[model samples]
Structures are given as structure tokens and as C-alpha cells.
Target chain A: MLGKVNHIAIAVPDLVQATAAYRDTLGARVSQSQALPEHGVTVVFVELPNTKVELLEPLGADSPIAAFLAKNPDGGMHHICYEVEDILDARDQLKAAGARVLGNGEPKIGAHGKPVLFLHPKDFFGTLIELEQL
Target chain B: MLGKVNHIAIAVPDLVQATAAYRDTLGARVSQSQALPEHGVTVVFVELPNTKVELLEPLGADSPIAAFLAKNPDGGMHHICYEVEDILDARDQLKAAGARVLGNGEPKIGAHGKPVLFLHPKDFFGTLIELEQL
Candidate 1:
């Protein structure tokens, strides 16, 4: 059902600034930073012992984060990622339980080459959820 | 700075049904369930590898979750809990970064004897964030 918390995503207008803010204020360092043009954003990760905080900054106007920020510019959380043992099984289970699946009907390689699936926010409330298999 | 992810909270209306849904769908079991009268809600946690999914249900008319669910009843996510080395230090850091603090100016004993603090949702876009230290 649930395995681990892979990451917590925080939407930001600027990754560099946010990363610096996190570092200077909390001593948390960015372990990795990369741009996912496909997702229209650049993400910087602050790794912790068991979880990581992901800073997501929009790369372009059409990016999802940009649209989200337009609606709520203060920048909020994007999604909660859960590490699952079997993603397909979990997706099926969620579907059977009346939750809508936003995945491409299959698992795909996501950031860090992990298999991932996204559930529609409409079904989960207003929060988007990502399921990743480690 | 940061230690781990204490939990990933999900807001649901019916804990028993959601718990059953998660268990049957993913083989994930509820590690613990309790009601926080102060918070006016009941929480059920599904343990995972590095994190957990907390299902929250409103307990009364003035409950926070009840208001949240009223806006989005399908039930999505609530907040992301991060494990920190020091709650006060984390709060100060976030405050220094111009983030608003929602705690009562001190860490309080939370579920399982952990010290917890909350940050204001206005500063975090619309997402409520909880900081906990083990």
C-alpha cells in the first residue's frame, strides 16, 4: 500500500533563491538539481535522512508550476510522493477503491529513473499525489 | 536541519473506510489511530519505509478538516510532516526566510511524544506544513 516517503515537493518561483533560503536558514543542502524540460520545471532536492524536500521552479510560462503559481503565487506544496513496493499493484488497488488514475495507463521512468504514477488531484481532494517504486 | 519525514497526511472524511481502502488495496496496514481533541480530528497512520500516510477525519463541526473537506470533500492531501533536528531552530529558520509561523510560539507534545510545530498556510501557498522531531 505504502512504502516510504520519497519526497515532498515545494513549488517555488526560483529554485536558486529557495535553495539558498533553505541552506542559509536551516543548514539543509541541496543534494541534486536538475531541469526536467518535459515537466517544464527545474527541481532541486534537499536530501534528509529518510526523505527529501524538492524545490520546483517553473522553467516556462506553460509549465504546470507557472500556472499553479499564477493562481497561488506564494508557492505551496505540489505533491506528496510515496515510495511503494509495487506501483502497478498500488495503482490498481486505488482504481478499485474508486480513485482516479492520472498515469499514462502504465508506469513510466520518472526523475532518478524510478517508476512512477500520478493520481488525479480531483480524486484525492485538491492535492496531487505521486506514487514511486524504489 | 532536517532529519526525516515523520508522515505525509491525507485528509479524508471517513477514516475507517479510507483505512480499509488502503489496507485492501495496498496491503498497507494502519500502525496507529487516535483522536486529537484539540485538533478536532482523528488520525490514522499507515506506516511505510521512510514515511507514512496519515488519514485525517474531522471530529466536530468546528474541526479544521471539516472545513477543508467542505471545500474539497473527495479528500486529497493535508500536510507534509518533516522530521527536524530541532523544532525551534527549524521554525526560526523558516521565519527568517519570511515564512509565517503558526505554532503557539513553542513546540508541544504531539502524537507519540514528539515535539511538533506548524507553519502558517498563507505563507505556504495553501498547504499546511507540520514539523516534528523525534
Candidate 2:
């Protein structure tokens, strides 16, 4: 069901600083900041050899990551995204196995414009998992 | 410079349950638990196509993750490991760039028998980072 790790999303209070840290300090190629108003977050991609590290910042008043930033002021790893061949099949299997799909249990177009669904952290040992259709 | 992401390490309170969640529920190939007493962790590797997810459990009273697990009882993402060409060069460059290295600033043999060094989370957007020589 699970394929490659698509990316690890890290929520940060400041996107510029986080981007600079990964680009200048860590010597990694980072992409420009992209604001997703629909998702209520601004993100920058830290491109690694094998995967990506997404640095996210709250965008609007009701940004999903706002509460997370409030709790983790300095920011932290928000979620891990894994790729799947078929998201609906994956969601059904996960649901049958007693895993809770977040939201309406329907896949939403994610940051990469792919269908994605989030699983409850409680069901996965306190780790928020995002399943993206590859 | 950073290479591929070596692996993402998740510290779990219960290794058996965590492994089962990945194996049985998520349908991923998981390796047998390997106890690294020297590092104070017992870990299982979740084999993914592109990279690996390391599930860790505290191996001793003095385990470094003990404090982390105490705060996050349900377990959470511990650290992100990035592969480096040379550990010493990476450490020196990171130090020069004002990033603080954990411990005595020397590379220690990590779980995979590679020289690894941990960076201070405070210096990296509150996310623990591990640099492993590839």
C-alpha cells in the first residue's frame, strides 16, 4: 500500500529563515515560496537527492498549521507523506483496518495537486500520516 | 553538502505495536527488531521503495529518547537523517555556519554503522537533524 516517502512536511513560523537555513546553511537546493491559499499555508521545497522536505508556514487566519505553530512555536515536523498507487483503495483498506481518515474521508487535492488524505495521528502511534496518490 | 535522506526516525513507545501498525495495517515490509544497546535504542526498519522509516524504542533507562517519549507518550517523529559525503567536513561546515552540533562535536557510529552527528534542534527550526556519512 505504501510506496516511497513523498516528502516530510515541517511547519515553521518563518518561511524565509527556514528556507535560508536549508539552502545556505545546509547547502541544499530549495525552491521558491509557494502560497496555497486554499490550503491556508505557504511552502518551500527543500530538494534532496531522494526526497523533498517541505517547509510550511501559516498563510491565513484559519490556517490549518496555525494551531500547530501555537503549540510548537519554533515549529516542528508536521506530517509524513507516503505515496500510494490508488488513494481510494488505500483509504478503504486503512478504514477497514480501523484507521480513521481525517476530514470527510474523501481525498482532497493536495499541495502537489494530487489526491491526498490524512490519517488520524492516534491510530498511527501519534504520527500524522498523509497518503498521496501517485 | 546533503545527499539523499538516509531515513526518517520515529521514536515509538511500543515497538511491537508500532511494527504491527506498519506491517499489518499499512502493509509495508518491516524488518526484525535490532537492539542497539550502545545507542540505547531497539529499532525496526520499514522498507519503502525510495527510503526507509526507522521505528525506535528506548533500550535502556538512559536512552536519549526517554525524555522525548516522556513528553510525547504516544510517540512521534524523532529526527530526520540526511546523508553527507564526509561527516567531518559536514560537521566543520555546519559549525562554521553557526549550527551547533550535539555532544562533543564528534561523529559517533550510528545504527547503520555509519559515522553520524546530531545537530541542535534549536538551530534548525526546532527539528532534530542527523547527518550520516554515506
Candidate 3:
């Protein structure tokens, strides 16, 4: 049910510094920072040869990543996303296997405009997993 | 300088349970556990289409991930590895750019038998980065 890695999300305190670190220091192509009010975070994509590294910053006061950044002040890896063929089927299978899905077990349109669902970290070795419909 | 994402490492407290979560629950092809005493970790590779997810468990008392697991008992994302063409050049460039490489600033043979160097997480938005020579 898990396909290619969609992206690795890293929540950072500052987007500009993080973007410059990836673009200038790391020598990677980075996209412009785009704010997603719905998701409550601003994101920049660091394009790698095979996958993407997403730099995220809290957008609003109630941003989902605010609490994470508060605990990890320097920021840290927030979640790992994997592409799935059928997200509903994947969610059902994961649920049947006693895996907990986040947000009422409903798939929401993600940053990439694709249906995505987050799985509880405790169920997957403390790794927050995001399943995005491919 | 950086190429494909080599793999994302997740430090886990229990290898068997983590392996079962990835294999049985997540439905991903997972490799047999391999103990790397030199690196002080046992690993299981979750084969993704574009990249791999490395599940790391402390091998011995002096395991590098021991402190990390102690801090995060439930396990967590340890590091992100990116492939590079020339590791020495990459290290030199990263050093010149003010990024501190871990250890004595020399490349060590990683678990995959490739020369790898770890960068200080503090300088990279709190993300431990590993650069492996491809």
C-alpha cells in the first residue's frame, strides 16, 4: 500500500534561513515559499533527484506545527509521506490492522492538492506517516 | 552536490515490533535485520520505490542511537541520508559553508559500505544529515 516516498516534512522556525541552507549551502533546487492557510503552514520544496524535502513554518497562531516547533525550537522532521494508490482502501486496511488515523479518519486535501491522511505516530514506531493518494 | 535521497533513518526501541509494523501492518517489503556492530546499530530496510527507510535499533550498550532512544523512548526520525558523487568534495564544501561535520571530520564506512559523514543537526535546522558517497 505504500509506494514511493512523497516527501519528508521538516518543520523549521525560519523558512528563509532553511530555504537558503538547502539552496545555497546544500546546493539543491528549492521552490518559493508558499503559504497554505488551510494547512496552517508555509512550505518550501527542496527538490532532490528522487524525492522532495519540505520545509514547513507555522503560518497562523493555531498552526498544526506550532506545538511541534514549540517543543523542538530548532525545528525537526515532522512527518514522512508515502504515495498510495487508493487512500480510502489504505486507511481501511490500516484501521482494520489496529492503526490509528488522525483527524476523524477522513482524508483531507493536502498541500499538493491530493487526498491525504495522517496515521498516528504511536502505531508506527513513533513515526508520523502521511499517506497521499497518487 | 546532493543527489538522490539515500534513505531516511528511524531509530526504533524495538526492532522486531517495528519490523512487524512495517511489514505486516504497512504492507511494505522489509529486509532481514542486519547487525552492524561497528556502527553500533542493527538495521532493517523498508524498500520503497524511489528510496529506502532504514529502521535502526541500538546494537550494544555503546550504540550511537542509545542516547537518542533514551530521549525518545518511542523512537523517532534519526537522520536523512543523501547520496553524493564525491564525499570529500561534499565535506569540504559543506565545511567551507560553515556547516560542522560530526566526529573528526573524516568519512567513515557507513552500514551500506559507503563512505559517509554526518553533519551537526544544529546547523541544519535540527535535522541530522548524512552524506553518503554514491
Candidate 3 regions exceeding 4 Å error are none
Evaluation by lDDT, superior candidate among 1 and 3: 3
TM-score per prediction, in order, is 0.84, 0.99, 0.99
Model 3: lDDT of residue A83? 98
The residue pairs that clash in candidate 3, if any, are none
The segments of candidate 2 whose C-alpha lies over 4 angstroms from its true place after superposition are: none
Better of 1 and 2 by lDDT: 2
lDDT of 3 at A103: 89
The docking category that best describes candidate 2 is high
iRMS of each prediction in angstroms?
Answer: 3.0, 0.6, 0.6
DockQ for each numbered candidate: 0.53, 0.92, 0.92
Q: How well does chain A score by TM in each candidate? A: 0.90, 0.99, 0.98
Using lDDT, rank the candidates from best to worst.
3, 2, 1
Worst 10 residues of 1 chain A by lDDT: A23-32
TM-score of 1: 0.84
Instruction: Report the CAPRI category for model 3.
Output: high
For residue A52, model 3's alpha carbon misses the true position, in angstroms, by 0.3
Candidate 2 per-residue lDDT over residues B3-99, each given as its tens digit: 9998999999999999999999999999999999999999999999999999999998799999999999999999999999999999999999999
